[model samples]
Target: MKKLYILFLFACTFGFAQNPGDIVITEIMNDPVSVSDTFGEYFEIYNQTASPIDIVGWTLKDDGTDTYVIVSGGESGTGTTIVPAGGYLVLGRSDDTMVNGGASVDYSYGDSGHTLGNGADEIVLLNTSMVEIARVNYDGGVTFPDTPGASISLDPSSLNENDNDNGANWCLSTTPYGDGDLGTPGAANNACAPTCQTTLGASDTVCDSSNPGATDDTYSVTLDFSGAATGETFVVSTTPSGFTIGGDDPTSTASGTITVSGVTEGTDITITVSNTGDGGLCDLTRDITSPVCIPINSVDLELIGIIDFTVLSGGSDGKAIHLRATADIADLSIYGIGVANNGGGTDGQEYTFPAIAVSNGDHILLARSLTAMEAFLTTPGYNLFDVYLEDSSEPSQNGDDAIELFKNGEVVETFGDIDCRPSSDGTTVTCPNYQFYEDAWAYKDNGTWTYGAAQCTDHDTGNVPSTWTTFDTPCVYPFVAALSTQEFSEGELSIFPNPVSNGNLTIKSKFDGEMKVKIYDIMGRQVLTAEMKTESLDVSSLRPGLYLLNVSLNNLSSTRKLIIE
Candidate 1:
């Protein structure tokens, strides 16, 4: 009887105390966009009970070799790690926001002991005695949000240890955190209740009575929703254009058509359907886009080429994009393009195509300057591109910048790694992070990307996008002989020691009087600006990479690509 009583006491001591579900892993940002994986990985845990849990000696591990003991809390290197009663705490690869993808890390697992896999990974927490507490294994596949730049978050309704294990209880965080990746770390996860899914249906362009004829068209499309219940209200909104939300706006979850009047010919509109909210607790948002109006094409539009032509001034004035239409688009305004500008990602649609129409075989060119664009065309000038628009503010790209193509305020495609810049080797090849195109260009053939020496391939009746030829000498496209002989009436300007390794860079020009000099980095950020009378400028303070030297003399100004090694 005494032995039985002792056994009962032992069960009471271990069973009711420190159990597995005491803490739960709620969020995981395995793939971070603002910073590298080495310093950006992080996860959040919540203490489920009404008692504070001191996790100072707890161990964090994955299914594999990653394992680390918490020697600290609210500190990075080492300290006490604690989870407040019913509160959340964040542990990450680094505690520095500048390096950890803008997350406020509560405790940092040293770089040596932890890493997150972008594909499939696990987060397991254990007690000091090595007893398993809680765990979550997420396969970065269909059931989870595999988008690299965002975090996978647990639904607020499923914040418990039991529900979080279900992949269906998580989603890609839509809330933008610091530096632009999406996730809520060190804070409560976003609510994912009254969840709704959206699908865009067929779209058509028709004459709008508001304009009296077909001169102005209204593009109408249908939005089909699922998983939304009755009494749930959905609000609708559009960007770059206004649209009339038809059936189900502020009503039940019935599908309906939305009509956008006075539609621009060459751009797309983003239609947002959102729940009115259960006073903000059960809100849902889904952004749907207008169809590409491609009757027979399966995928959306494609980016065919990236050009950095060496114009008359040997400047990147010829920065542009080439595209071919897959279907006869009645309105081209449904598409837009933006340069990621250095490594910073997704500066959404800086240039929107104006209202226009094009045939299935038409070739379109979006250029930063039409004057510079004419210099790269057929012999006389302006003969290749079926449609062209010059937007001085857009396609303001350098050799290493990434490009994003937007449809309805969303990035439907990208040309390069929007988050990676050219490394010290003059190429992203070290990381294969982003495609490098300096004294070269890239073209797409049969949906595959191919890089070649900067060459001219004007439209041909036979090859369509036209095959390019490569030449390794003279740093200029051989076809430049047929380029327009447009001279700079403002006189000539040049730079000596063009690829300046160190010391001063000398600016040579006919208008060599007092000049306003500005040097901008590859990202278009002005780093240095000054007014000087002499030609020599000190550049020793600048880092080694690509820069643009903009020199203004009297009323004339010129920009040239300056390389620093």
Candidate 2:
């Protein structure tokens, strides 16, 4: 039955009525008007039939001196060669040859001297005796909205090459394969096989018996990592336009990157290979066998927020030393004291070797999470007012939502839910639910708990706090500690007395400097400017119920809400 199928295919090739063989020119890139160099121009051919056919003696030529002929002797001009049905054949210039391993011709075809533009150009394919088999009179190349470099293409599939002489465009292949979208190689169809990759520690072992008796060689590639450690990977690849393995459709890679991980010591990996297509030296399959796996370990720890400070109040009057406690994935038990003031009057709490003491002029705050570590520090007052997660850990997670501030192993304050930012879950579910409470000061002063405006609240209704928890004390009220939230980066340049009836706003900065101010109306139109040396700005001149005031210093800008009384 196989021989009969072969005979039937051969007969169709000779008949050449309408490409009788199983092969089809799925793609063609023949256009007379296209301005392309050698690599830029080429033809593509695809086999649509179910059987294989030898495309030997296929000759390609342009009206100019640029001529490309397949050197036939075998499969790749090597032996009895055949392009299996449904396969692809990419034919391009010498520059394009690297794309498909095909022969490259001199670039003399589409030059300005030949006037091969805005009109038809003559291209042909011939057999051994110079007998015209296939040809094309490509119309002016197709034009894209933005692309100037484009070519023509042929559609559908055909079995045999056309046996004609003049004026009949016989050049078959013309699919645009360079677009990175691996479609049918030589056919106009943009359908290509999805990439196939091996498991992390697996091999790409494909058998050749699938396409038995076919000249298209099949190789088995084994990606070996035997006798190596763990976590080893390497790139195994092949070149050629239509090297399709494991399937009939044209594919970008028969097999992709192979990696081996968690291998027991002294076990080598073996990856197999297969190359089932027609081209020059298509079966040069190899492997990155017995590769050594390097072991590298790293931890991404982040400072969540400041825990609590071991305040030694006696050493420095009005100043307390703070020891920051951190929790992370790597080391959870031990902690460190980040920044402190080394002023006169030795601190009782030594942090360097035994412990470090906090001195005057030194303020401690929580640092950001390096990985999963949460840092906690005391505001200026040592009152344990506000507990801020690291800027990185603004968003908290489960397990350590509220860090316990212990004084010498005694739980003095239990910071309830923290508010980093807002969430969709509703104010109660959020850590920073301060803004939701109409009377946030009342909630915090009630001796209950201070909620961050970011605490989740359901806005579906009038945005309200759904969950409430009373804390023994506020985390860190930098505002009350004289640190001033306004001095903090986020709270800098805030205007108090929001309902100012006189438009007299007081601007305060952590750092003292001349402040440049600009007031703008709701429409973003600037109406006033006060480059004053004082911290207070009088905006009573501007008529406004609501306005935006921009405070700038050293090119850094901060905005504040301005209300005119």
Q: Give each model a TM-score.
A: 0.34, 0.22
Note the clash tally of each candidate.
17, 112
Error of 1 at 98 (Å): 2.4
Report the lDDT tens digits of candidate 2 across residue range 259-349: 3233322233432332323221122234333322211111111222222221222111111222222212223222222221111221122
Question: Which stretches of model 1 miss by more than 4 angstroms?
Answer: 1-17, 73-75, 78-80, 196-565
Give the poorly placed runs of model 2, Cα more than 4 Å off.
1-26, 30-36, 48-50, 62-68, 73-81, 95-119, 129-131, 141-147, 156-188, 191-565
| Cα lDDT tens digits for candidate 1, 220-293 | 54555544444555566667546565655534544555545555533466666556554322343334343333
TM-score of 1: 0.34
**RMSD score of candidate 2 (Å):** 24.6
Worst lDDT 10-window in candidate 2: 310-319
lDDT of 2 at 74: 22
